[model samples]
Target: MKPIVVTGGTGSLGRRVVRELLDAGREVVVLSRRARPVADGSRFVSVDLRTGDGLDQALTGVDTVVHCASTLTGGDEQAARTLIDAAKRAGVTHLVYISIVGIDRIPLPYYRTKLAVERQLEASGLGYTILRATQFHELVQHIFSLLGRSPIVPVPTMRFQPVDTRDVAGRLAELALGEPAGRVPDFGGPEVRDAKSLARAYLTATGRRRLLVPVRVPGRIMAGFRRGENLVGDRFDGEWTFEQFLAEHATRRPSRFTDAGGSGG
Candidate 1:
């Protein structure tokens, strides 16, 4: 069997997906723009998705491609287009993509680009599976950390169903192992929670005491969040809860916060 190529294999979710595939005893190739240390189970292939530099070569003889790479500085569409072209030339069997839930309802520019990428992937004629997930627990904690910079943290009057990245990785690995299924059921956390409560929980977990000021952020994005656009109440596909996630990361990030990404999931 040919190897599975994973774009952004060094990224937060991509790395986890690589681990899952490796544990499943599948050959994995981790593609990155620059060289990264790879002494583990997977092979590292340096390739650029934007300029198409080395992308075609790395994708050679690959059966599946799990596209986990995303751009915050823009050029996401270009990278996806470049990758699709390369995958077609390589005769890749399946292309799995990760997306966010309720991107269509939210009017954020980043969300718009994500939706556009989903459509582009669908029309690419490649066997593709799209997994739309909710906000990540790490990302939510990161937001609270930023808001908690001052003595009074302004908590948004919104709700979010944040899933664990580990769970998302497992789901993506399962989808990659299976045949193409377009836009599978949206994945979310076990509970749908308001931001204020989550913020308090985060503060307590991080051992910080700050006045949580519940502020109503007026905007289409906030309105969408308030309406739980970032949530999938019908089904909760994730196994880890926000509290469990916090427990694991309680020591990792005690003072500072790192963004999972600009967008959720």
Candidate 2:
């Protein structure tokens, strides 16, 4: 099998996917925007998806490319289009894209970009597999940690199904190694919890005290989350829960948390 190239291999999900592929004894190449160290047996190549620089060289001998590179900021569509073009020219046999669940139903900026990327992959002539998953536990933790700083945490009255990044990475690795399937079943967490409940759980796990203010956020995106548009009803495929994830990573809590909202990914 030709080596698999993982875009954004330094990111939370991409890094985990790279590790999984290497563990399976498959030749893996880590593609990133900047130079970074990778797993002992894996290769690393600096590739900027924004400009397509180094992308062609990175994909030269790569038969499969797992696209985990995404940004909460803009330019995701351009990046996806550029990647599809480069992958086609590089003779890639299969392209696996990791996407977010409910991007079609949600109207958030990030979701819009992800949805557009999905369409681009669908229209691309190259063989592709698109796997959409719920938000990761780490993302939720970041959001909560941000809000936890204040005396009263204002949590939007929304719902979430936070899956583990490791689980998503495993699925991506499997898809990278398998035949391309257009779009598979959406992956979700074991249980769906409201934002307030998740916030309380996080505070309790991290040994913090804060009044959680559940406010009705007025927006189509929040409305979509309230309507369970971000949830997968029949596909509760992940094993890790929010509580377990908190317990496992509680020791790495930052002394100061940022005051930013959670990302839509």
Candidate 3:
């Protein structure tokens, strides 16, 4: 098999995908804004997706391209255009793009960008597969950090079926090696969970006694989450549950208030 090129190879999901490909005995080339240190046999190339700098070199002799690079919170269409144009120039055979579930139904800027990119891929006349995945376990951690120090964990009233990044990576690698099938079934975690409950569990794991506050966000974006727009289709399957993931990496730490001696600083 010709080498597989992974855009954003230095990112969280991109790195996992590259590792999976390499483990399967396929040569992996990582494309990023800067060259990074590689494992003994892995390869890395510096390429800026924004300006299309060094993209042609990154795609040369690469038969499969796994587009894992993305701008957080949105900016999908521009990224897709840069990659597709370079892939066409390089004569790449397969293009596999990773997208979020419910992008079409959600009104978030990020989701809107993703939906636009999907449309572009469909009309690009390239052999392409778009794999939509639910939120990752790390998303909870991100939420906690974003909320900062509060007496309670305030979460939007939303349902989620988060999946493990590792599982998503494996599936993407398989798709990159196989034929393109357009939009595939969405992948989600093994069980459904509410934001408040998940937040409570996270607090408990950290030995905190904060209340889990469910907030109803206003507007179409919030409505989308309330309707569980980020869930997978019935045909898709995943192996990890939120509890299972927590058990594997749970750590006990004092609450922020306790750390600051109950001062509301």
RMSD, candidate 3, Å: 4.2
lDDT value for model 3: 0.80
Off by over 4 Å in 3: 73-75, 233-236, 248-251, 255-265
lDDT of 1 by residue, 1-265 (tens): 7889999999878899999999999999999876776538899988888999988889989989999999778988999999999999999979999999999999989899999999999999999999999998989988987886777777788898999989999999999999999999999988888887787677768877676667899989999988888899898888888888888785433544432222231
Candidate 2, 1-265: lDDT as tens digits: 7899999998889989999999898999998887777778889998888899878888988789999988777788888888989998999989999888899998988898888899998899889999999989999999988888787789988889999998899999998889999999999999888887888778778777666667898988888988999889788899989999998886444434432334321
Query: How do the residues 1-265 of candidate 3 rate in per-residue lDDT, one tens digit apiece?
Result: 6899988888878888989989899999998876776544568988878789889988899888999888775555777898999999999988999999998998888888888888999999889999999988888656764553577556788887878888899999989879988998888877787776677666666677665556788998888888888887474467877777777776776765432222111
lDDT of each: 0.87, 0.87, 0.80
lDDT of 3 at 124: 94
lDDT of 1 at 14: 88
Clash list (residue pairs), candidate 3: none
Candidate 3: residue 208 Cα off by (Å): 1.8
Error of 1 at 197 (Å): 1.4
Q: Report lDDT (Cα) of residue 205, candidate 2.
A: 80
* Candidate 1 wrongly placed segments (more than 4 Å): 251-265
Clashes of 1: 0
